[model samples]
Target: MTTPRIVVIGAGLGGTIAAYEINGAVGNRAEILMISDSDTYSFVPSNPWVAVRWREPEAIQVHLPPIFAKKRIGFTSAGAKRIHPAEKRVDLNNGESVNYDYLVIATGPDLAFDEIEGFGPNGGHTVSVCHTSHASEAADAFEEFCKNPGPIVVGAAQGASCYGPAYEFALILDTELKRRKIRDKVPMTFVTAEPYIGHLGLDGVGDTKTLLESELRNRHIKWITNARVTSFEAGMAHVEEVADDGSVKSKHDLPFGYSMLLPAFRGVPAVRDIEGLTNPRGFILVDKHQRNPKFPEIFALGVCVAIPPTGPTPVPVGVPKTGFMIESMVTAIAENFVEILDGKEPTHEATWNAVCLADFGDGGVAFVAQPQIPPRNLNWSASGKWVHLAKIGFEKYFLRKVRKGESEPFYEKLALHVMGIRKLKM
Candidate 1:
């Protein structure tokens, strides 16, 4: 019998963890290969720290080749130029192709800053923390702005699904300014597309609205919700506030000396626009089992997968696929793939719960939205200084786990078990 070749795309957080867990599950029964655009793994959750120069890029990045090789997994830094799912092959940017018996797409989202006029870090009006390079550029811009503090705008743009980073950066920025003794001089405004202050794309988990609102209030950060940012130029942001009935409530010309806006995200071009595989916005469509319905051999996890808006609001608010949810998907895929290799039907399904930890510099907020939708099994939110410390510990533990090429270590399981968080409820 031929050794079944399994190819996993994108070595980001989900992909790296999936590769490690899959290797552990399947052992040497199948050959594993990982393809990524870069040979490094970055802890994306720490990008806000990078933006504020609290953490350097190298501190959060791990080289992938050596790590994968140590685990006896194949590695390719060349990105996929095109994915021919019908032919079960991925054409590489370097004129090579990889054939796989099973494929996992964890390629993550492609930031859609181009959707807005004069947005993003490049020759644009605002900065971003979506990528390491972008975060590094944002650090420089942040330092310059600190030297001459003025009005600052920090939030997520229209069509942006991930609200955590926007909230995080705003609070972190506030903390940094207070530390610099310029909090009195620099006025900050948060502008988001969510219908309410703490909607978070899942319609406000627990008392999130109250918890986050109080935090913003205590920090003296004013906000605008249900806001559609039409464009930006130099120091101005054009915003349109919409009512619940889908009518324009008001329009405003907001001024800012420094801005950082998280843009909308879509699937990467390689597998995007594929028939029966991706949605119109280029996000991969997968079944409850994490497998593409049209292509049973294909599975996707992380931001690349398409999830609908929680409900109908005046403006669309896409649901966020939090890091914990993605890890659950990875575990599900690994377990089911092992079943497939055993000549049995795959039965594992990811629980898809969302556990988010959003840290400010000194304090933070966290929420658990079981199943990541309304009417959840568990809906809770809380805030404390320990959340900030927990986030720091999580970053360190995740980085160490990646470097060691282990998916779920004993201590990790023990901690989560104690916290009552399960990767998947068996």
Candidate 2:
């Protein structure tokens, strides 16, 4: 009998770790292959620091080809052009196709910058930290902005699922400017689609509403919530403040010498627009076991998986797929694969808990939300200088794991156990 093939698409944080954990679980029972656009893996959470020149790009990157070879996993960087789920094949950009017995879609998000005019780093007025390359370019722009600092604007756009980085970059910029003594000249404005400062798409974890709002006020940063960015000019941003009734309350043209706005995300083209496979937004639809209902052999995790909003808001907001939550999904999928190989039903479920550390250059905010949504068992948030330190430690530890080809190391599992944090549901 031919060995079953397992293909994992994308090699970001979730995909890379998923490959490792799944390999550990299934052992030699199945052939494992990873398809990624690049052979380098970047620590995405540290992109904000890269933008401020706090860390070099190479420092946080891992060369994946060596790691995969050492782990005895097949790898390619040809990238996927399309996924033919019905045929169990993925067409590559390099004019090749790979057939799989089971596939894991972890393509992450496709930044929807084209939806808004003059947005994003690509041929756009503003910059981005969504990618390590973008962050490097942003660092150059920051140096230029400092030469003649003026008004600065930062926030997340409508349908932006990840808000922690926006908040982190905004404060990191603040911290950097203060250190340079240019903060006095750089008037800052934070604009977001969220109804309030700390909604964070999960409806304000713990007292985040108060914690984030107070931080902004203390930093002398002005804010505009329920904001929809209409467009961007060379030196200005057109924004509309919406009322609770979904009407425009006010309009403003905020001038900026430098701006960074997080764009909305959708499923990548490779797996999008397929009936019964994805939602209208192109995010893969998965069951409780992280398996597609129409295609049980297909499992998905990370930002590519479709998740509903916690509730409704004046503007569109998406629930964030944080690090802890993605880890849980990875664990559940790996366990389910083991069950399937054993001729048993796949029954594992991820906890989907959220644990985030939003670092400013000097201080930061931390939050924990069990179940990651509303009306949870535990919802807590805090802030201090220790968070900044913890974030640095996390970045180093995670990069080390990638370099060493280790997932869920003993120390990590022990720490989570002590903190009562778990990846799988009981």
The lDDT per prediction is: 0.90, 0.92
Cα deviation at 324, candidate 2, in Å, is 0.3
Q: Name the 10 consecutive residues with the lowest summed lDDT in model 2.
A: 410-419
Model 2 per-residue lDDT tens digits across residues 342-380: 999999998888878889889988888877888898887
Off by over 4 Å in 1: 409-426
Model 2, TM vs. native:
0.97
Query: After TM-score superposition, what is the CA distance of residue 176 in candidate 1 from its true location, in Å?
Result: 0.6
Candidate 2, pairs of clashing residues: none
Residue 107 accuracy (lDDT) in model 2 = 94
Worst 10 residues of 1 by lDDT: 409-418
Candidate 1 lDDT over 37-133, as tens digits, reads 9998999999999999999999999999998999999999999889999999999999999999999999999889888899988878999999988
RMSD of each: 1.9, 2.0
